[model samples]
Target: MNKLGRKLSLSISLAVIVIFSISILLTQYFLPKYYLHKTKERLEQVSNEIKKMDKTTFIHSKETIENKYGITIVYEPINSNVDELNEVVFSQLYKKRITLNKFWITEETLQKLAEGKKVNKIYDQGKLKSSFFASFMQRDDMLVLVGNSIVHFSDTAKIVNEFNLYMLLFSIILIIALVWILSKKITTPLKELKDVSKDISELKFETVHIKTNDEIE
Candidate 1:
């Protein structure tokens, strides 16, 4: 096979590969982005319902929680010790928790909770899994906080998440570059082949001496 033929074949194969790689990359990029946007929209709709009541409300609600909020639960209680107290505590806490949009609390926020004050809250981007509630009320000589881990955020957790996102984006760019270069190399030969074929057909040569297809499979 002549040098020209080999080059043409290489270009054809490269074109094929580049096209395939581009298709794959586009699929990878768009599907996740589309679904993520959809999820964000859906979550945002529900996210606004979270409510954090004042400590006094948290306390007073406990007395009437069962009558006000009790319903059949999917999970049964393992132990039935002190049923009324448990129901009251669970209902008061769960009602507040169910309305929370994001899982996070600051020391200032906790302080307010302890003092029976109200504060606006935002979700902690660092922690993906916060959906807990807490109540702090002064009793005699002590300040008590009752909260579940579901609504807290940590600084280190946010940093780690940001790092992972950067790594994912870097990996995506690397893959795209690899695909692009491979596409260019593979297409170069195919372009040559197209030119050569055109010349042959246009001329209608009785005997062509070109050995160009040597590299073409």
Candidate 2:
């Protein structure tokens, strides 16, 4: 309804907000995973390289790999120094603060890892998602677990959310301004016609004028 700017501004703003909100929601749901997938691919490559190293080299450089790539490394011994299921041998989270000390690794996963297998898992934390890619390799009496977490995506998701909020505010303001201008342009002739009718009814014979050439005029 172009009766006045208020209704028009409100309707247009709501419409634009619905569309933008859908877009932002979709982005929030999918974009982080897309980024995490890309990150997983890279992590897989690095894990593959680690799988090729001997047991000693892997244990010695576990910290270095964790530091260099900003991942968490955990070594689970199978044939050698067996740790309690809850005991973690080596870990470097790099400030990710992930509560996961034991990953999705199971006996089946360990068996596969012993044969130089790579595993990829996804962790969901409320609206946030993180990725884990690991390689399991057997070294004589030790099982080496090398992995990287795409927890950095949490920061990216936060940035995107903030950006979406700003964009929504901007869109509302812009749509309100445009709708106000358009509403004024559209209702001017009708408003003038109403005034002319009112004057004629009162027998105050004045020249009735409708400027637009449209049928309403």
Candidate 3:
């Protein structure tokens, strides 16, 4: 490749690298947060729908809700002790025995729920990486708990970065080919001019035919 082709290729490759680097950095910084926000919003919507259901409907539609939203639905008496709430909710949701500390529910969270506020949190402990969203709403004497576990997207981000890497490689190859062709087109006329000057210097005046249809010709 000529000097112009090499320069063009280098400049274009550097630009592509910079752009891809910024894109990957931005994705790493914001994608998880954005995903979490949307997941929480969806869970909140589901919780609202659950809040509107009567006890009979809620119970009857439990399977439908779980299957539709990929969530777990459980309810308990509003008068249940707040301290034991976490255990009850966790057991009902996961159907397993886990320490109370593993659950994200706390006194404050329970208080907010009692006040008819939605609760959302991230649970990342003991091989569990999930976004937990819940709301406690009264349906007669029962407090309906609508909750969901959303898996984190670290693997998805990894796949995206891998795809960007492949795109960068493909773009570099394309840039190199385009730059080579462009440089050759631009320099060909200049090479002919150089030869014409050399012939005139040697007193070899001849009819020179250059028909590039540009100033170089």
Candidate 4:
């Protein structure tokens, strides 16, 4: 009875752990990817709006666009260095970098921009990260680099993973308790049957204690 109870408990625990662990793994993997894809689409839409704007409108509505989307737009002239941006634009860039300090603009990024392409990028700064859709199009003689910040799905993914871990732990503990109780109930009849068989082997009939509705019990 003791051995059978232990086996049942172990089996139940493994089954519960396997099922919930897979669910947790899937949630951890797919959900963030979905969020990231959605964010990319939104940022690309913002980039399109910027592309259609005239220089005067873009300059005037820059702050509004940034505020509306929770993003910073960095405009760089083809000839000027990144550090040589105008004071107002530099200030906006400085403010945005307060949280995320690092960004990259590779050859591919520049080449794509030269071809009037809007490229999507993922930027990381230590623990902080965000997505951006970048485009370098004709704005007077200058090539304007406009980027929009998208939602940081990685941060949300971390929070979700932590919550699921705690829930998984709690559920496992609960299932173990339930399995133990059920194993005890199931073993009761078997214990009674064993004792009754012992008495009959010695040529004595004894009242059995099993109360199950089955004929064998």
| Highest-TM-score candidate | 3
Locate the minimum summed-lDDT window of 10 residues in model 3: 96-105
Count of clashes in candidate 4: 0
Q: Give TM-scores for every candidate, taking all chains together and pairing residue i with residue i.
A: 0.27, 0.51, 0.71, 0.54
Q: Write the per-residue lDDT of candidate 4 for residues 90-154, one digit (tens) a residue.
A: 45556666343555555665566667665665655445456444444546555565565555666
- Across 1-217, the per-residue lDDT of candidate 3 in tens digits comes to 9999999999999999999998887777788888777777777888778778777888899889878987666787755576676566767767722222355557776577667666666565535554455555556666576665565667778889989999999999999999999999888888887888899999987766777788877
lDDT, candidate 1, 128-178, per-residue tens: 544333333333323333333332333434554465556555655555556
Each model's lDDT:
0.43, 0.65, 0.74, 0.66
Which segments of model 1 are wrong by more than 4 Å?
Answer: 1-147, 154-157, 201-217
Query: Between 2 and 4, whose lDDT is larger?
Result: 4
Q: List candidate 3 stretches off by more than 4 Å.
A: 95-101, 129-131, 153-163, 189-217
lDDT of 2 by residue, 1-217 (tens): 3557888778777887888778777677877668667667767766776767887788788778878877666655574323343244333233346555445446665567567655555544334455455555555656555555555455666687788889889988887788778777778877787898898999877876666677876
In model 3, what lDDT does residue 41 have?
77
Count the clashes in each prediction.
Answer: 11, 0, 0, 0
Error in Å for residue 193 of model 1: 2.3
Candidate 1 minimal-lDDT segment of 10 residues: 70-79
lDDT of 2 at 158: 69
C-alpha lDDT (0 to 100) for residue 13 of candidate 1: 49
